[model samples]
Target chain A: MFLGVLFSGGKDSVFACRRAMETDSVVCLITVISENPDSYMFHTPNVRWAHLIAEAIGVPQLLWSTRGEEEAELSDLRDAVAAAKKSYGIEGVVTGAIESVYQAARVQRICRELDLWCYNPLWQIDQVEYLRLLVEEGFEVIVTGVFAYPLDESWVGAKIDDRLIRELESLQKRYGINPSGEGGELETFVLDGPILKKRIEILRASKTYENYRGRLTIEEARLVDK
Target chain B: MILIVDLCHKAESLSKYEFVDPIASIVRRTGSEFKVRHFSELTAKEIERSDGIVLCGTPLKDDLRARRIELFIWIRDFDRPLLAICAGMQVVAAVFGGEIVPQPKIGLERIEILKETDLLGPPGEIEGYHLHNFGVTLPSGFDLVAGRAGQIEAFKHSGRPIYGIIFHPEVRNKWIVERFLDLG
Candidate 1:
């Protein structure tokens, strides 16, 4: 069956897409750009890079702009999925849902309305195993945003690898933080993966922190030949 | 030692698989050492070297399905403790005189074990994450041990160390893998 992935330019979404690709052909990547940075239902940060990463994966990207109003954004998601269905013949929509009952239920509702299968390959699986596979599979991931204690400014622009996974595991022992950043403790961006044709290079970036929250603004980036 | 026969080969063409990796983790969780080999590379000598076997599933692509059918027939006479998952189970059913038709209501369903067995260990409810478009019929001389809404979920040979399950034990039931390994 053909699939359309709701890509958020994050490790979870990109990795979900990879998992979907394992079983079925992913014909399109759906990216929603939320106007609200504090959106609860959708990711807003590093969204501008969704297309570039989609390009890197060599898949057709379907885009949508949402006003970020609470439940209204879900309608925009339906519209994006409709467009993908009409254009790509997608039989299902792939999501990066981990342990969020709220998000999974909403996406499942929308998929039910659209008569399309909602596939959450990462749902309820062990996060430690998920992070380890990301490293082993050569997924180039970076932290773009952090918004919790114990994870400070130093984490803002760090590449996630085996070493980082260990650090996160230790932090989990103390703070009970999610190793995959599912707790909104941090946000990530994927620069490359096994499926990507090119790798992204952040030539310039600036990190800022305030009151335990931090962000690395990617001022410039370019795709380099792998 | 157990052998994970990863039939999701022809990786140069087919997509990378995530189906059986969790099984690998399950093996490690049981403190078991296992080796993975592509189905094309599997041999009788290899089967003789292992304690048990787990045959993994893949999409039923025509060429790959042909290769799989050949392999199932090739290994039909295997007497070792063997467990197959999803597509692998479908392969077992097709090879052992059973039916495989397109699945009608394909979604998440709770499977209840209808019969008792050491491999299931007092089975009551097992959560099955269903995705395949096909369903398998009980093969000849096999017990219909599990089902959901009358659809078959598991079956075992009448008198052999072989079993086939429709759901992914790696996803929801680590105990099932442990039980299968224990049969070795």
Candidate 2:
């Protein structure tokens, strides 16, 4: 079956796209860019650069914009998905939702309305184990945002590796933070992965941190050879 | 050993990770051994060797109508504790002479447990994750365990330990799955 993934250029969505590719053809990558940085429905950090990730992965991308109002953005999502169905003839939609019922349920409702099958490959997954899987599976993911305490400026631009995974595991036990950032404690962006045809090279980026909230804005990036 | 039967559209389909693996993970976390097999690939020998059976859900778009519902004829005679979820519930109900009605639901909703069983303890209201295009009617010879008669949220066989629930227990109600394992 041909499917379209709700891509955020994040580790979860990237990994989900790869998993979807294993069983079926991922015909397109659908990215919903929200103006609200704290949008509950979609990931926000450096999502506009999703086209680059799409180009790197060699999948056609469908970009949609939303004003990011809480309930109103869902209609924008519906429009985007409807457009994907019309353009790509996608039979279903794939999501990276792991534990957020709020996000997963809304997407499920939209898919049902659109008569498209929805798949959340990372639903109810073990967070720490999944972070480990991301590194072990050759996914070069970096933290792009941090929202919770005890995670300071250092995490904003760090690559996810064994050392970071160990630290996240310890933080999970000590501070009750979700290692995979399912709880909105952190956000990630995938630069390279097993499924990507090319890797992302960050040319220049700026980091901003204050009082346990931080974001790494990728000002410039280009696709490079893996 | 618990047998987790995958009811997705096909064996090893993309839906397996969403529907099957989570339940398998929950069962594994209980320290009980489990084996996962698609409904079409399940053998009588596999069923006979299992202590309990958990028929997992599927993507809402991949209901049992696309597959051979007759393959589930084994459910009628199997006396072990069997818990069917979502599409699996539709199969269990269809096998037992029940109607599969169009009751499309998605997202987290309130579930009222009308009849308490070993699987779901006591009658109360609890929120459960529901993602299905259809729901099963109360199959004959099955007691209404939850929800109203027509819109059965949960049901159990009158004489056996067989059960069917529309909600995906692997979501917020994983205790139900762990409790089903305990029923083994």
Candidate 3:
């Protein structure tokens, strides 16, 4: 059956789709962009890069943007999901929900209202192992946002390498940071992965550290033809 | 010490405001130690040993089938100093005689304290962050500790030491955390 994958370009969503591909055909990647800087609903500040991930996965991507701070965005997401079902004729939707019941429940509600099957492949996987698998699979991931102590701007451009994993482990041991970067300690974006048909090369980038936070701004990025 | 129960199935994706930073700040301010244990990881011994419990917000909303809900039920019996945030608040209410219903879709609304209890003292209106669609209405025995804009914003168990606030006090104000710590 054809499926619509809720693609956030994060490791979890990508990994969820990869596992689902083993059993079903994923037809579209859906994402929601919230205008609010501090959105209680959708993933913020890092959603701009979702397009790159959609391109890498070589699937038709749909991004729904909303001015709704948090809950209002749910209406936007519902509208997008409905449109996707009508246009794509997909029978099921897949989510990369690792832990947030708030998100999973909302998605489930939408799916139930639409009469679509909701698939969550990484529903209960261990956070540490999930990060390990992302690295093991050679997904070039980088921290794009930081909001917790012990994780700051220095981590913005840091790669998800063995060294980073070790640092995360140490942080968990020392400062209660989750090794999976759950608890909003950090957020990431994938630059390259197994599903990518082309490589993304960062041509121009600027790193800024201010307001007790750090960010790596991609001034220029391009998809290199394979 | 505070024990944060990780009810989230995907704990990694939650924001720092929801769990990590608030707990860390509370620990630092109170000079108290804290540990995070997932619901699945906890043993009966661990539950009994907890002095003060903080139920961290889960990505999952009110899912009756969620295994974490069962764990919450087990913890409810312990009757230790308890605090539940967004999803945690909903779970606590559900465990008690309260019900969780969808809230109006609003962001950063003003929550007026209707009455005073030890939880939010002096009974004055304060602005608080709201991110949940569900609200709690306690049963007969539970005393209404606080209210905001006509809804029951916070409550205390009549028969137990249990307390809950619908708004995220830890994320909004330090006094809330301080008060919870004081209870312990």
Candidate 4:
């Protein structure tokens, strides 16, 4: 079965696609480009690089825009899935929701309305395990933003692996934050994965911090050899 | 608050996404806290601190069985609200002189609820998903509250909040643990 992945150019979405590839043929990467940085349903960090990341993964991407309003973002996702079904004949949609019932339920409802299967391989999954599995499966992910205490500007552009997993575990014990950043504590981007044909090389980037939260803005990135 | 004791096999084939996540999700959905620890790492102090405890599933490795048996004794003595699920239940039964018989491979099997208990929801027929290579023949004190024929589905400690269920409650009857939320 061919499926369209709801991509955010973040770690969860890319990791979800990788897992989806094991059981289904991933037809396309549907990325929602939200203008509102604080959008409730959509991920906005590093979303501009969806095309490059899609190229690295060798999947055709469908980019859609929205105002990123509260409930209206669900419509944007529905439209993206509808387009994927029309263009690529996708039978299902994949999302990277682990612990967020808000996101998972909305996607499920949208899929039900669209008459398509909604697969959430990471639904209600343990974040510590999710992050560890993401790394153990040979996926290279970098932190793009940190939005919680204990995870400050230092986490920006850090790669996720065993060492980072340990740090995240420690942070989780202290701050009770989501190890996979499901609580909006942090955001990530995948550079390489099992299904990716090429790796992403970050050429230039900058960090901006406000009110203790910091984001890594990618100025330049390109696909490279594995 | 709930404490989910992890007995999941840590073999290379198994990731850390133990069956406890779904159970913890139920706990979290009910606006409670959940803390997870490996059976070996768990201390009696933590057990005393938690409102309830969950003994999650794991492969019946010889080493795991030994550790789980030790933990089961400690859990029984603590006398806290406990739900021993799947292999966790087998460990509890094995500690009580019950025989753990390796069974034929089976899938979903509906079991009749012989009596009412807070551990399992409702009183009538309930379909449970089974995926175990082993089942327990209970000792003298344990009572069979729910089962399908000779196969024991659930057993109560006769006095405590402790329960042992052969089938996986997290998958099929997720609402099975809803009663456990109010336990603590």
Candidate 5:
């Protein structure tokens, strides 16, 4: 059966897509862009990188833009997924929802309404183990946003490695971080992956720290053929 | 190090929800360690082996069954410091002599600390997220620590180390988590 993978260019979504491809042919990658500055639904302000990841994965990418506001954004997502499913004749959809029942439940509801099977392969996996596997699998990931108190601008562009994993373990021992960034403590963007035929070259970037939050903006980036 | 008891299978993922990073930041700031494991992973002996215990929030709406009863018994006998948020708070109330009944759907709201307690720090109002339908009616000997709009927002067992807050401190302001880490 053909499936659509929800691509966020994040470790979780990439891993989920990888696993889904192991069992099913994923036809399209879907991403939702939010215009709202304080949107809770969208992962980041810009998702242009997601387009490159979709290209690397050898799948058609669909960008669905929304206001990023709560209920309205959710509606837009539901519509987007439904449209993708219909247009691509997809039988199912895959998500990388590690936690957050609100997110999972909403997606499930949309899938149910669209009459498409919803697959969340990484739903209940241990967060620490999941993070470790991402590193072990040679997925080159970098921190793009730091919203938690302990994480600062220093964490931006930091690679996910053994040292970072150890730090996560230590943080878990001390602060109650999920170690997986499941609690919105941090956000990441994958620059390269196993399925990637090219690497992302960041042309220009800037880090802005305000209100104890650090956001790394990718001013310019392009996919370089490897 | 902080020991968070994973009550429900889905509750473990609550750590991945909002404010997870900030909580991690606090942990890193304090140079402490934290671990999230299922309740079944801990025995009575293990329960006694931590600096502090945080009962993570669960999606389970009600905890009035036999399994919950057994778990509550274990928590009551365990004399370690405890902090409960959202569903954790409801479980705490039910475990103690307090009662948990359906309350209004109050989303994110500023919690006014009615009294100064070490759990929340010097008395001041703080913004906290509330996503539970159950509210607690404190039993005797459990003093209320904080509240919002006349609701029993937070309460601590006077003679024991158990504490419960109706709102999610982990998802709220960083100070609440800082105070919780201080317990460790």
Candidate 6:
């Protein structure tokens, strides 16, 4: 079956695209770029680079813009999925939702309304283990955002590896933070992975952090040969 | 050992990691051994060898498995402890003379336990994750353990250890599955 992945240039969505490719044809990547930094549903940090990620993965992308209102973004999502179905002939939509009922349920409802099957390949996954899996699966992910206490500015712009995962695991035990950033505590961007035909090289990036709320903005990046 | 039956649309489906593996993770965390088998690939030998059976849930859109109820007839004779979740609940109820009705639900909701049982403990209110497109009516010779008569959140056979719940326990109430494994 041909499928379209809800892409965000994050580790979860990129890994979900790989998982989808394992079982079905990932025909396109559906990207919803929200203007709101505090968007309720979609991820915001460096999502503009989703086109690069899509190009790296060698999949076509359908980029849709949204005002990022509370409920309006859902309609934009629906429109994006509808467009994917119409243009790419996608029979199903896949999401990277792990434990967020708020995000997963809305996507499920939209897919249902459009008469398309929705699959959450990472539903209810163990966060720490998932982070480890992402690393073990050869995904080079950089922490792009950090929200919540106990996670300082150093977390922003750090590469996710064994040391980072161990620190996150320790924080999970000490502070109850989701290691994979399920609670909006952190955000990630994938640079290289087993599913990517090309790797993304960050040329220049800027970080703005204050009081544990920070983001690493990729001002420039280019795809390099893996 | 607990045998987790995958009731997804097919074997090795995209839904397996979503629906089946989470339950398997819970069982593993509870320190119980388990083996997962697709409903279409299950065998009596494997079923008889297991101490208990857990029927895992499927995606909301994968109701195609429900129409193939003939594959679930083995559930009627297996007397060992069993627990059904969501799509599994529908199958168990259908095999036991219950009707499947369109009762779609998604996301977290408050579930009121109607009666005390070994699986769910005492009657009270608890939030559970629900992601099902259909709900099953109370089957014959089964007692409602939660929810009202028309909307059955949970049920168990009057005489057997067979149980069913409409919510996905892997979301928040994994102890229910742990308790079922402890029943062995």
Across B1-184, the per-residue lDDT of candidate 4 in tens digits comes to 6888777644221213425567777777778888978777777788888888888765323235644476567754757788888877887888777877876333466788887888775668877666566788876677888874358889888878888888768655777787777776
The pairs that clash in candidate 6 are none
Q: What is the per-candidate TM-score for chain B?
A: 0.87, 0.97, 0.83, 0.88, 0.81, 0.98
Predicted chain A of model 3: TM-score relative to the true chain A? 0.92
TM-score of 1: 0.72
User: Any runs in candidate 4 off by more than 4 Å, and if so which?
Assistant: B1-117, B120-184
TM-score of the A chain in candidate 1: the value is 0.97
Q: List, residue by residue over A17-68, the lDDT tens digit for candidate 5.
A: 8877776788988898888767776687336678878887788987888888
Q: What are the per-model DockQ values? A: 0.07, 0.86, 0.03, 0.06, 0.03, 0.82
A87-123 in candidate 6: lDDT tens per residue? 9999999999998889998998998889898999999
Lowest lDDT sum, 10 consecutive residues, model 2 chain A, at A37-46
In candidate 5, what are the lDDT values of residues B6-107, reduced to their tens digit?
654333332232223334445566777877656556666666677788776543232333146456577677566788776677777777767777774334
* Model 2: per-residue Cα lDDT over B53-152, one tens digit each: 9988988888654358789899989999999999889999999999899988888889999887999999999989888889888878999999997678
DockQ category of candidate 5: incorrect
Q: A20-137 in candidate 1: lDDT tens per residue? A: 8887899999999999989877777778878889999999999899999888888988898999999999988888877665676677667766788677777656788789989899
Predicted candidate 2, C-alpha RMSD: 1.2
Please state the CAPRI-style docking class of candidate 4. Answer: incorrect
Q: Relative to the unseen true structure, what is the C-alpha lDDT of residue B137 in candidate 1, on a scale of 0 to 100?
A: 83
Candidate models: Cα lDDT each:
0.79, 0.91, 0.70, 0.78, 0.72, 0.92
Stronger candidate by TM-score (1 vs 6): 6
Task: Please give the lDDT score at residue A69 for candidate 5.
Answer: 82
CA-based DockQ, model 1 = 0.07
lDDT of 4: 0.78
For B1-184, candidate 3 gives per-residue lDDT tens digits of 5787665554332232234444555666578888777656777777788788877654323243133456666845767788777677777877765677766432355766765666678778887655455677775567777764337777777767677777656444658878887886
TM-score of each: 0.72, 0.98, 0.55, 0.61, 0.58, 0.98
Best by TM-score: 6
